[model samples]
Target: MQQVRAVVAREKDAPVTVETITVPDPGPGEALVRVQACGVCHTDLHYRQGGINDDFPFLLGHEAAGVVEAVGDGVEGLAPGDFVVLNWRAVCGQCRACLRGQPWYCFATHNAAQPMTLADGTPLSPALGIGAFAEKTLVHAGQCTKVDPDASPAAVGLLGCGVMAGIGAALNTGRVGRGMNVAVIGCGGVGSAAVAGSRLAGASRVIAVDVDDRKLEWAKGLGATHTVNGAQTDAVEAIRELTGGFGADVVIEAVGRPETYRQAFYARDLAGTVVLVGVPTPDMSFPDIPLLDVFGRGGSLKSSWYGDCLPSRDFPLLVDLYRQGRLDLDAFVSERIALDDVEAAFDRMHRGDVLRSVVIL
Candidate 1:
């Protein structure tokens, strides 16, 4: 066993504390990672809030980049000293989704066979199965997706979750094409990444809609072709006006709220796709769009899971892009913080004041 410092949310609605966690040596099909950096995502805050579940004493960080410290029996293709981005979904190739060749939709993903626990031997529920806000963490061998070591760990770690989701929403789920007009609602970290993705995918017009002026400004830097102050104007009307009254070819709803979802619904051009990347609370209702419109709309309505990404396929490609300076991933990092600063980071995130506060170990 190894003792390491980690952020732990002991119970629902309680503050997280830095504590010593006992991480066991890698067992079969597992690897031990020394986390270099982890991004402070909203999902981590959700875990702390018990929004994900009632699971107590959760190990609460997932968006991570690390170096492999050790690989256990039967592990292959990875070794000590390898730089990697930790992924939550370690696909089971025999699962229905993987057998069907859509491993991105794998239904039976898993984590390490054994658990990392508190000093008292109480098992900790790792956030998204990747508890990365630590000096070290244990994960399934498949969870470590190797990336170029030259890339920035703090920036690339964001790709483990939020940024990847945004990019994948446009490239994979929405199928945004050249000359397509795209509008993304909620210009937070994920939404800004969507704007970047739209531009990368060759969308001629990428409109970012957000209430926060700061977020809109950040979106512009990430390749948004235009910006809309949704608080100042009707977002649907503004989007239509920008698109010659035809609406957008693809509308990404990155905020999981009924009102914003309705805005996305009406803001789409007929037959245009709608990609919902934001997570909604269970009490949130589906938008009350008319049934007739649902039947009349000729396009797809989809939910993006982890940006519908295949880590092995996408992580390295994105890292290379970042290294080439084609992708401005570093823009998403608002600041670099110590692991002990997680609580303060949550405050900034809740205020919608920053894109991401990364914990650098």
Candidate 2:
């Protein structure tokens, strides 16, 4: 076992604290990662709030990049000293989804079998099976996707979650194509990424909608062809007007709320796609929308999980694109902070002051 400094949330609605946790050596199919950087994501904040589960003493942080420090028996293709981005989906090849050749929906993802423990020997539940808000973490070998070492850790790490989700929503789930008009609601990290993805996918007009003027400006910087201040206008109407009064070819909802979802549902052209990448609370439910309207829409309404990303195929490719300056991964990282500042970072997130505050180890 090795002692590593980690940020731990002992209970629901409590502050995270830095503590020394015991991380065991890799077991079969596992690897130990010496974390270089981890992004403070909203999911981590949700985990801290017990919105995810009742896993107390939760070791938070998931979007991360690091160097492999050790490899377990039976682990192949990965070795110590490899630069890697941590992924939550450690696909089990024999699962039904994998058998169907859609490993991105792998139902049997692997995680560390051995638990990291607090100093008192109490087992700690790692968030998203990663628990990367630490100097080091243990994960299934399949969770480590090798990427370009030259890429900035703070920037690349964001791709592990939010960025991937938004990009995937546009390119994969939405099937946005060249010359298509795309409108994205919400200009936060995930939404801005969708705008960038739409541009990369060759969308002729990428419309970005957000209530915050600052985020709207950021969206323009990320390649939004047009911007809508939703707080000041009807989002659906704005999107339609931007797309020649016919609505967009693709509408992506990155703000997980019934209101925004309804806006997306109505803000697309006939046979156009609507991709929901934003997560919603369990208590939230959709209001009555005529089933006739659903049939009348004549298009797909899809939900994107982790941007439907097949990490093995996507991570390295994205890293190369970032290297080539085709992808602006660095723009997603709004700030960098020490692990001790995770709480403050969370506060900033709540205030909508930053896109992402990464923790550099």
Candidate 3:
């Protein structure tokens, strides 16, 4: 057993505390990873706010990169000292989705069979089954994806979550291809990554739409060919004008709001794809639209669950690209901070002051 300093939310709406938690050795089909860097994400804040569920004394932090410290019995292809990125999805082969060859939508995912606990022996619910804010974490063997050791942990760690979601929203769900005109609504981390993905996929024109000009600038740096300031002009109209007045070939709704969803619906040309990668709150209602339009619009309307990504297929490739400087993953790291600064990072995130504040251990 190892005692690691971990951040946990003891109750709803309370400040997170860094407590000494006991992490057990890797059990069968599990692995222990020494976390090298972790990015502070909004999801962690959501968990602390009780937005995810009622599970209290929850261990937070998910987007992470680390080195494999040990592997348990029955593990394959991973060994001690291997550099890796941690993902939340650990697909169960017997799940219906996995049996049908779509493991990304696996009905069941597994975690560490043994629980990590607080000092008093109270079991702690690790956030997203990945409590990596600590010095070390225990996870299912499948959660560790081996990547190039040369890549920056702060940059590649992001591929574990938001970056992958945005990228997959374009490449997989939207099926964006060469010469296509794509528009991404919302210019936060996910939407900006969508813009980068569109460019990487060889889109003829990538338009970024957001209420904030600062975010739009960041989008341009990430390869957005055009940016639409939604606060100043009609997003749908501007996208149409940018796409020769016919609307874009693909419209991605990265802002999970009724208003933005509606804009995405109207902003696409007839038969264009609409991919919703943004997450909506439970209380948010789906945008009401004419029933006939859903049938008449004539294109796919899909929701991306974790960008519909299969970790085994995407993680290493993206890491190699980042190493080659073809994909500017470094652009996403707004700041490098210590673990204790996570609360301040969340504050900065809420205030739109940074893209990501990484905790370098």
Candidates' C-alpha lDDT: 0.94, 0.93, 0.93
**Of 1 and 3, which scores higher on lDDT?**
1
| Alpha-carbon RMSD of each model | 0.6, 0.7, 0.8
Clashing pairs in 3: none
Flag clash pairs in model 2. Answer: none
Clashes of 2: 0
Off by over 4 Å in 1: none
lDDT of 2 by residue, 261-359 (tens): 999999999998889998999999984679999999889989999999899998998889899999999998899899899999999998899989999
Instruction: State the lDDT at 191 in candidate 1.
Output: 92
TM match of model 3 to true structure: 0.99
Question: Which scores better on lDDT, 1 or 2?
Answer: 1
The alpha-carbon deviation from the true structure for residue 36 of candidate 3, after best TM-score superposition, in angstroms, is 0.3
**110-221: candidate 3 lDDT, tens digit per residue:** 8999999999999999989999889999999999999999899999999888999999999989999999999999989999999999999999999999999999999999
List, residue by residue over 74-122, the lDDT tens digit for candidate 1: 9999999999999987899999899999999999997998999999999
With candidate 2 superimposed using the best TM-score fit, by how many Å does residue 246's alpha carbon deviate from the native? 0.7
